[model samples]
Target: MGHGGQRDPSEYRKITAEVFYDISRRKNGVRPCPGQGFPTDIKIECSKEIRDYPVGTKVRLDVVETDKEGSRPFLYSSYKWEHEVVE
Candidate 1:
């Protein structure tokens, strides 16, 4: 017996950011409207990679924040997550 009445284990995927301060809350899918979205929160130790992605960089978050939440393996079909960064 569970509280949420049992979620379909098959349909759920755990997301984790590497070297996180704290794994308090974990989200499954996070997307933006008409754009690519971060499927999960980020916890990257390499700030350089995070920094190099300057404005106008159409980037796909292919890194893992934690072992639990492996990466957003799939891409969103509706919205193109490419960012047109402004200087």
Candidate 2:
């Protein structure tokens, strides 16, 4: 797993990786020490046979950028699993 945060709003940041997974889980672990365990943000609820993919599968992510109104304008990004790669 990787961890990152917004450093600037106007610049573009790149995340380089060789492989991607079809399933993923996100958790917020930014609290102070002695905090609660990692709370799940997303997970597949169905049985593995209904919705399962081979491990180490490459997946495509759909990213959306939006502007938030505040004292200072900030860019926010949201990502989702768009599709699985055939090759």
Candidate 3:
């Protein structure tokens, strides 16, 4: 049996940068399930210029699951950053 609950691949999800950071960085070296041991400096692959978005810039991401599985199922098979709209 799998370690964690299995999820449907067709079911996609969106998450904000804040949520990503919250899951990525945790106190006492304790991380949330599924994303345990996730890399801090993740290099996002996108055609859009990454430099356009400065640090601390809030952004949304659309992610999906991959065939890779480690301590937990990887949910970053591919993703695209949503463009931030200026007021």
What stretches of model 3 exceed 4 Å from their correct place? Answer: 1-9, 18-48, 67-87
lDDT by residue (tens digit), candidate 3, 1-87: 112335573454544332222245341121112342334333333323323444344444544444443544444423233433221
Instruction: Compare the candidates by TM-score and give the number of the best one.
Output: 3
Model 2: per-residue Cα lDDT over 1-87, one tens digit each: 122355443343221111223332432111111121212222222222222444433332222233445533222223322333432
The TM-score of candidate 3 is 0.34
> What TM-score would each prediction reach against the true structure?
0.21, 0.21, 0.34
lDDT of each: 0.30, 0.26, 0.36
Q: Give me candidate 2's TM-score against the actual structure.
A: 0.21
In candidate 1, list every pair of residues with a backbone clash: 15-69, 16-66, 16-69, 17-65, 17-66, 18-65, 18-66, 36-81, 56-85
Candidates sorted by TM-score, descending order?
3, 2, 1
List, residue by residue over 1-87, the lDDT tens digit for candidate 1.
Answer: 121323353432222222222335342232222222344333332333423543333333323222336653432211211223222
Would you list the clashing residue pairs of candidate 2?
none
Error of 3 at 79 (Å): 6.5
Per-residue lDDT value at 49 in model 3: 38
